[model samples]
Structure formats: structure tokens, C-alpha cells
Target: MNPNLLTPPRRHGERPTTTGLEIPHDQLDMFSPPRVRAELVKQAQALPGVFTGPSQVSEPSSLALRLRQPLGPWEAFLHPSTDEFGHIHRAGFLHLTLPRPLLAPLVEAGWAEQHPISLRPEWPDTIVMLYAPRDDGELDVVLAALRASWQQASTEKGR
Candidate 1:
């Protein structure tokens, strides 16, 4: 994929506040309302090669997005214990894997940040916590990021 294509425009306003290293990592502001959050889950589950399930690495209430047939590198997963490419928190933020090239750009653009666990040597640095979509426009961008993750998981590309 073209790096430019994955580079979304800088998100407007300041980055939403988050509980950076907390176990229940969460975005405290710029929330995706219940309706938008539901829609995001609905649309993300509809993405090709994906299915919704209880997260293998998150709270039981969190929704995990898994690839039915993964062909990409291990970096496509939030953890090696599962094929999950992403999972939406009850608070609406998401933890997903992105291609290495897309990582810094997304973070710099203020759409996401590296997952706290990702700082560990055992974890893939590709893991990131995508901020919640506060509205339709942001939802589109979040979905695009999810699609990028789906594409990465459905291909054989290396990190």
C-alpha cells in the first residue's frame, strides 16, 4: 500500500486525553457516542475477512476483530496468542495493528498512539490504540485505519 494513502489528514483540535499506561487504556474525551460506536462496530465487523468475537487479549466486554484467514506477518495481531487484528474497547477506542510505515504517521497526525505494551521488546511496535471516532467523519478515518489493518492481515507482507 502507498504510504501516502495510509497517511490521513491531521485530526482537528488537540488529541483527546487518554489514560496512557493504564490497564484499561482509554480515551477520556472526544468520545464516540453510543450510536456512533455501535455503527463503528457494525461496519468494522462487516469488513471482508473479519469476524467479531470476545477479545482474546482484552476485557470480556471488548469486541475482537479477527481475520478468518490471516496471511500477513505476526505484526498484524495485537498479540501472538490470537489472530485478532483489532478490538474495540467498551469506551470505543480501539487497539489494532498497522504496518510499520503507517504507525509514526498516524501517531504524529493524532489519530492514534502506540499501545503501552508495544514498548516492550516482546511486543510488536505495530500495535496502536486508535482514538474513538467522535463523529461520522472521524468514523470514516477510523474505518480506513481498520481497513488498512484488515489488508495487512489478509496479505503476506512482512513488517
Candidate 2:
């Protein structure tokens, strides 16, 4: 992926609070209102090659965004059972995988942080916990991030 295009503008405002862990990982502040969350999910599901379903690696209540046909290898997924590159948490934040090259920029820009689990030697370093979107403008940035993730997960060269 081209880092230039995938790199989003620095997110405005202080970063929302987050738990930064796997089991209870979540955004603790600045949650998206129900209407905004719903709209974000709707638009994400409408992206090309995406389909929503129960998340195999997250809380059952969360929405999994899976590629209809994942072309990349297992490294592209957070878990192979669902081929999920990302999922929207109940609290409205997201857990997703991005290309390794994009991780630092995304985090430095205040858009996301590295998933704690990814710190382990066995895990891919691409996993990140994306902060929740609190409004329409933020939702647009989140969707753009998700779209980059989808493209990475679906392409053979994603790794």
C-alpha cells in the first residue's frame, strides 16, 4: 500500500481513553452516539467485498467486517476462523489490522494505537485498536482507515 494515501490527517483533539487489552479492550471515552455508530457500521458494511457477521475473535455482540474472499495469507487476519481484518466493538471503537508500514503513522496521528496482544513475538505487529468516532467527520476518517484495511486484507501483497 502507498503510505502517502493510506496515512490520514492527524486526528484532532486529545485521544480518547482506551483499555488497550484483548479481553476487555475498549474505548472508555468519547463514544460514538448510537446514531453515528449505526451509520458507521452501515457504511462499512457497504464497502466493496465486505460482509458483516458475528466476530470470531471479539465479543459476540460486536460486528465483524470480513472480506468476502480474502486473498492474502493468514497474517492478514486477526484470526483465521472468521477472516476478520477488523471488528466494531460494542462501545464503538474498532480492532483492526493494517499494513505494518502504516501502523506507526496511524498511531502517531492520534487515530489508533497498537493492540496489546500484538506486542507478543508470535503475533503480527499489524493489529491496532482504532479509537471510536464521535461524529460524522471522525466517522469518515475511521471509514477511510477501514477501507485501507479491507484493501490490505484482500490483496495478495498485503503482507
lDDT winner among the candidates? 1
lDDT of each: 0.85, 0.82
Misplaced by over 4 Å in model 1 are 1-6, 157-159
Q: Output the lDDT of residue 156, model 2.
A: 80
- What would the per-residue lDDT of candidate 2 be over residues 40-93, giving only the tens digit for each residue? 799888988888988988888999998888886566788645478889987789
The digit string of per-residue lDDT tens for model 1 on 34-106 reads 9999999998988888888899998878999988887888778878645799999887899999988888888
Clashing residue pairs in candidate 1 are: none
Worst 10 residues of 1 by lDDT: 1-10
- Cα lDDT, model 1, residue 117: 91
TM-score of each: 0.90, 0.88
